[model samples]
Target: MTDTVLVTYGTTNGSTAEIAESVAEVLRKAGLTVESLPARSAPGAARYDAVVVGGGLYAGRWHKDARRFVRRNRVLLADRPVWFFSSGPLDASAAERDIPPVRGVQRAMKRLGVRDHVTFGGCLVDGAKGWVAGMILRSGKGGDFRDFDAIEAWAQGVADALTPAREKRH
Candidate 1:
């Protein structure tokens, strides 16, 4: 049987959603049935074989709705294979800093036993954000810093993990 994977994300200016789509594509290529959705619209986690949740970072926190989804679904998530990712760091140099996920949601993630957490480089488009975001961009760090190759590699790793389970079932 084909495994089903759910890729859910919360995006501010749509970058994280694009990232989530990229992840879904990679998983699809790995032969898993994939469904990508915004966190607010996610039906639920019960039907998926694995879950991937990602969100954009703002002011050192993930998008609120994304965190809330994990919190509300904590029990179910704990019983499944789940991975989390955060998209932020507007420049390549910043990507090397390795910031942790927002502290407020760490407990839920721990309880859920998330498989892995990754932080991807982000994109900043001119005038796409609020005044403060614009100011942060103006601080000489504004561009699409996302590394698609890295994202694909990580998705492949998840696929690798799931492959063993698939083989076992067969």
Candidate 2:
């Protein structure tokens, strides 16, 4: 069996956290050992066979804390299979346009040699956010755009990449 670490950035309404959890569940059901944690608390990826790093995209940028985690851990992650994802875009049309995928995350993924990368539609509830957060939320056009089926399918790809070579021979 392969061991995996799925780390992500979570936020106030917890939408991104839920997305990360769903991906972790998919990886777990695939018979791999997996760990999921907030990016601020995430550890280096070198100890694992594979890593999946996710971020909540806001204002066309990933959370600062998550970006820093990927930055500090980049060298360690380059040696492992690293998959990158962003929770973004509230609508299918915007998703097609890649709204929240800022360039920093792209650069980080490129530096780490990410095997799979994508953007998952995320969520926003006016009632659930702080004052400043709500103000910023209104400017962008997105809310709960996450497609669970698509998220799972992407995760399955990660699972396939992390699958044991011995298993592949079977």
Candidate 3:
């Protein structure tokens, strides 16, 4: 049986959701069955062979929805291959260097034994919700900073890591 993977994310302005979709696409191309969903609405991790969870960073914390999802599914996730990602650097810093997970994400990864974690550039275009987002836009700091090429490369790595296990299961 093909490995089924869940690619889920929590986003404040939809950039993280786009990143999650890119991940799901790469997994599908790698011959895995993939489901992409918002963390708030996603089903439990027990239903999938693997899971990829991502969230937008806010004030150095992962989005609340993503945090809750992990907290709710920690037990099930511990048994599966799981990856975590964070997107929310408004600059090129994430693309230029390794941006470590925030403290909370780090703790969660340790508890869940997550296979890998990555931090991607975030996007904050106009029309984003919240006064801060508006202020950032007005201040000219808002832009689409996501690096799709890097995101896809990371997803490919996740696929590579899971492929051996998938073959063994068959």
**What is the number of backbone collisions in each predicted candidate, taken in the order shown?**
0, 2, 0
Model 2 Cα shift for residue 132 (angstroms): 4.2
TM-score of each: 0.91, 0.84, 0.98
Choose 2 or 3, whichever is better by TM-score.
3
CA RMSD, predictions in order: 1.8, 2.8, 0.9
Each prediction's whole-model lDDT (CA) = 0.84, 0.74, 0.94
Model 1 scores worst on lDDT over the 10 consecutive residues at: 93-102
Model 2: lowest-lDDT 10 consecutive positions = 93-102
lDDT of each residue in 64-159, candidate 2, tens digit only: 767887888788888877888887666674446644357987788778787877788877766756675667567864356788898888888877
TM accuracy, model 3: 0.98
> Which residue pairs collide in model 3, if any?
none
In model 3, the runs with Cα more than 4 Å from the true position are none
Query: If both were scored by TM-score, which would come out higher, candidate 1 or candidate 2?
Result: 1
Candidate 1 contains a number of clashing pairs equal to 0
Query: Which candidate, 1 or 3, would have the higher TM-score against the true structure?
Result: 3
Rank order (by lDDT, best first):
3, 1, 2
Which is better, 1 or 3, measured by lDDT? 3
User: In candidate 3, what are the lDDT values of residues 57-145, reduced to their tens digit?
Assistant: 98899999999999999999999999999999999999899999999999999999998999999999978999889998999998988
